[model samples]
Target: MQGQHIPTDAQKDEAALWHVKRAGGSMSVAQEGEFDAWINADPGNRLAYDQMRVLWAQVEEPARRMSTAMAGEKPRFDKVRQWFSPGRAFAGVAGAVAVGACVFFFNPDMVENIRADIVTENETVTDVTLTDGSIVHLAANSAIATDFADGRRDVELLRGQAFFEVTHRNGDRFRVHAGPAMIEVVGTRFNVDYLSRNTEIAVEEGAVRVSSNDNPQGVLLGAGDRVAVSTAASLGDVEKTDPTAIHGWMQGRLSVRNVTVGDLVARLDNFASGRLVALGDVSERTISGSFPTTDVVGSLETVAAAVGAKVIRTSPWLTVIY
Candidate 1:
């Protein structure tokens, strides 16, 4: 022990918090290995991380109870109650595994003050019904903030795609904010894809007014119309679209035609809990088929097989296709 370097108490606490935060988002291949080495460096690191896990669970217990109560269902936190039991801290051999593994924080925790009423985790979809008898279908890996007050209904696509079925209310309109686009709906259904910096709108029923930071004057879209407007590129050509092709994902099947593999992979990520990276030259290759959202990785493999590419699954949380 003469040459051993021990981390201070403060350093242990810092390392614990840092690991928790790093686990919040997708970790790269390098990050995963670095995380393992950092924790294994000192016994204090494992102890501090275990304590942080228990504390983090305690913070979430109340919210779980509240959500259960609001759903008119019984509490479903047996494991949470165990975490709170005196002398039942996540410890010992189990504690070491818990400290090293990513369990407590997967996606970023939705801190207090996030206005979203419903949030779907990776590969999960949440459907919300408003007081006005309208419905919003939130896709997987998506978050939306809803505001229905005064005389109007507004839903913001904070990230990912959402399908809105709006019902006209006392002559007031329903609006969706996707990046720079302001979509006003008049008793219609439509899908909005807001990922990265690009926004695409596909109208299925009625008409909508689409405006963006670049073209605020707005464009009118009727049923069966689709357009893509992004900050990085000029607005896409507004054209007639097939309703089935645009809205098929709602039924668990994604239909794509003449689309690049890059785009197909991006769409697949919406329903995949793990991260899928399409590398290099394969991105530009075209792909067409009806990919099932139920079997996300299988669909990727199916697509890869056709193009003489390969699917490399590094872990449950990371997959690479090339």
Candidate 2:
């Protein structure tokens, strides 16, 4: 560590603010002068700024490729441009591409809108009554497709979360598919969340037979039971939970007992206009709160405070948490 410069928290925050302002658009004459002076003031300052810019580009690389691929264009970067200088056209293009990603890639509801039988936007919930009189409470930014045929009542949750109040039928089996996990129930009220790496199920009434790729035989979950199945279809712990809290989003509140900061942020991202990128491994920190689904930014700030972290708005389309 002798010849290296480590940026302090203050330095990092200043660099992040400067990057956001510069990426916002062209800077005013005086603002540009101030930025140049601040960045040139110390070797560590320049290092911090460059690090911020590089982090932005790295996180955006996937989104850029996704956008260009959809447009039938190749993904390329300006190799000669300095990462710290936000005035580069490359930065502007990347930001614009990120905006497109927010609309198309990150927002799965939009990508799957055509194929989904039911979809909900952010900060909104919708109730749909199926052919068999079963009711579904679709959460914000969620999508689902249904098929009822041959004595089979199937619902595929393409993305996000949903609560089902299934009605009983004499010879029909009601089943829900989320990622690699499958849940079957005759008549029950349950919640299923299709997360980034797992599909979670919480039973509020009656019982459900849950199976995943790892556990093909499946496990039976009754009232007040909750379980998470990994993307690989492996089962997680079957724990006790409050039935009311299981589908709390339907009431416009998110209640958690001991959720990790990362998981909380992931839920908040569904409501955010852009993205919430956690800078470090903040998973060890956990928080318990009942956040308002309508005020996502406020809930995010509360979560950050509980985890002893900072929230930096790096751009209109990106927020970095540390």
Candidate 3:
């Protein structure tokens, strides 16, 4: 009988890097090709990557419990001895945040600004009127590059989200490119958010045509219509939305329904300095709430309370919820 092939330590490390790189969602064309080549290089390489993925998935629950205990929260059992004060506990967790923040806080915006025509910092929103008279309400931590040429208007969302009140001009088309999706309108008010790996589109007035890389035929969305396109370029079902609520972020508000703690943290992270990380199973729990984006610490506490979790603000730049 032949012995089973085992992936070498180098292969394991390379596989881990590949997983992180892909999760970062900033892979270049050349990097993607290199990734494909590496995956096809050997069967052992695939096995190692698969192992890494499984290991990552399995750690979530344990991470939650450990983080909760580390924050000086009351454990499930009274018998368990408490080892640290709340301040010291948060300091320990903050130390971990400091390490992870290096990756999470990696200045992607700096790179984004290289090609961005307009950029907004955290906690700030900007309004820009394009040469064609189209108005864009760019959200915080967002960047956009505009091109008004060839008798057409085009805007690419480099990062974050934006609301467009497009101006009509002799049937010339206005297009907004976000992730795998393209939104085209003649004259309309609409919102596009590409903060996550996916792109979400919502129309406020008039109509717009939305298409994705996979769905080139596209779909026409009227006012109050909302949809999302996944990272794989797959279109989601169109849903009805309230036009007034479509751009709530503009008012420093975020409305969520049955949203996971992890996802909520990610959105709130955009409005404040530093980062908010949900550790352990608490991150997976779901809750519904309307949070004030301007009051990130208060909002985090409210979210944690709703989910029966605890919030630990180790510093201005780091908050851990578990």
Candidate 3 regions exceeding 4 Å error are: 1-106
Q: Comparing 1 and 2 by TM-score, which wins? A: 2
Off by over 4 Å in 1: 1-115
lDDT of 2 by residue, 172-282 (tens): 789999989999999999999884556889999999999987788899999999998987779988999998899998888888777777677777767665665554445
lDDT string for model 3 (1-322, tens) is: 1126467655665665565456546478998999999988987788877766675455334444344223311112111112112332122222222323223223335566789998787787789999998899988888899887777699999878899999999998899999899999999999998876468899999999999879998999999999989999999889898787899999999876666887788788788665676655677789887899889999999998888987765433346776
lDDT of each: 0.66, 0.73, 0.73
TM-score of each: 0.64, 0.71, 0.68
TM-score top scorer: 2
lDDT score for candidate 1 against the true structure: 0.66
Q: Where does the lowest 10-residue lDDT sum fall in candidate 3?
A: 72-81
Error of 1 at 317 (Å): 1.9
> How many clashes does each candidate structure show, in the order listed?
0, 2, 1
Q: After superposition, how far is residue 111 of candidate 1 from its true place, in Å?
A: 7.5
